[model samples]
Target: MSFRVGNAFSDPRVTMRQPQPVVLIRGTLNPAHVSAFYATAFPELASWLNLNRIPVSGPPVTLSHIASSTMMEVAAAYPVTVKVPTTQRITMGTLPGGPVASLIVQGSHEYLADGYDHLRAWLGENGYGPGPVSWASYIRLPDEHGDQRACVTELSWPIA
Candidate 1:
């Protein structure tokens, strides 16, 4: 399918879009803390975790849910063709119409963090403020495959 790059929301959040099924969990998480998060949060649930890393930009999530403090909301995502949950049989890549901002970059996660910092500062300047932390995920960009520099991910911040 041809994913068109949108300049703006042409018709609000109702535009025809491809949304994927995902799972989500909340609470403080990072690469070091993810193992504990998984163990404590959803032990009995099925899993489809891709390349593992602590998130410095987007919100910590899985294939189906966005676990926030008070609400558990579903999101939009593209398909992940990896075998994860046999029953679910799908993964997520990105969530279009992210409601705030998105930045796609090809670099290390640290570089991505730099970009995120810049975006955060820019948002402050533009009065966007802080929104829900969301992410457009991808398969292993940087992982045990020795391609630590090619991790490409889209960082999205749904601002308030």
Candidate 2:
């Protein structure tokens, strides 16, 4: 079934963020197959991090190139406590940190795009435009062994 977003909520404050080290997995995937894509991608990232002895300092993040809807080059990233080396699909990079607008979403994964729509609308309303990229940080994910009724995500766009 096609997903539809309902209502969206945003934090009142938009802040400047500092650049931080992250390990990312980049690939192109269809929007409709994101769940399956992540299922295979995230674990490989997790294993790579574990094998490299890197500690996860923050939530999992997925960044997208905002230009296309059919197929997108997306990056799945995990913030690390310390800088690490680039290897294979996982690479060392910085998550874009600067002027950003964010929306906190709490719901099923299928509806997460609704949060992005809200954020985009809010950015345009406030005279902010997409700065080449946008990201969704999974504040809370479905359990490894089970699913949850709600998931918490922060949808953010770097803005001018």
Candidate 3:
């Protein structure tokens, strides 16, 4: 699928954020299965939250803990207004708040690698080292919108 990258990004900036509460389900799966994982995980998370009467504070987000060619450890999460009890599968946690190099990318999932490459290059050029975690907040999802190619994601990489 064809999607625009740099042109859609807001200028990358370093911003300080406060730790936000979240509920998530994490898994280690093959790289090719990540999309399918999100598809299942997000709906389950939403249903769990609704059942618990917890309000979602922001858009659905995915946290990348470890990534490699074969497999990756990732979490599908929703920002919650308050901390909630954890379930057998879902856990309550926080999106660590700190200095992050952040940018907005509008495109299809196929173009995400290119967007991340640009972010990494920018971090290198700007003399910043990326921290352990990185994440993408799905502002507008392809399935939710009329056009499957139209999506907006906010990418954040913690910087040291």
Clashes in model 2: which pairs?
A: none
Worst 10 residues of 1 by lDDT: 6-15
Global lDDT scores for all candidate models: 0.43, 0.77, 0.84
Question: Per-residue lDDT for 115-145 in model 1, tens only?
Answer: 5565566577777764544554543455677
The C-alpha RMSD of each candidate to the native structure, in angstroms, is: 10.4, 4.3, 3.3
Model 3 CA lDDT for position 32:
81
Residue 149 alpha-carbon offset, candidate 3, angstroms: 4.5
Error of 1 at 138 (Å): 2.8
TM-score of each: 0.45, 0.86, 0.88
Question: Which portions of model 3 miss their true places by more than 4 Å?
Answer: 1-7, 67-69, 143-146
How many residue-pair clashes does candidate 1 contain?
9
Measured with C-alpha atoms, the lDDT of residue 93 in candidate 3 is 78
Model 2 agreement with the true structure over 1-160: per-residue lDDT tens digits:
1233445444424789987678898888787776677788889999988987889999999888744768877788998868788877679778777887877776666666766777787788888887777888899887775574467788878886
Q: How does residue 139 of candidate 3 score in lDDT?
A: 91
Q: For candidate 3, what's the RMSD?
A: 3.3
For each candidate, how many residue pairs have backbone atoms clashing (under 3 Å)?
9, 0, 0
Error of 2 at 127 (Å): 0.9
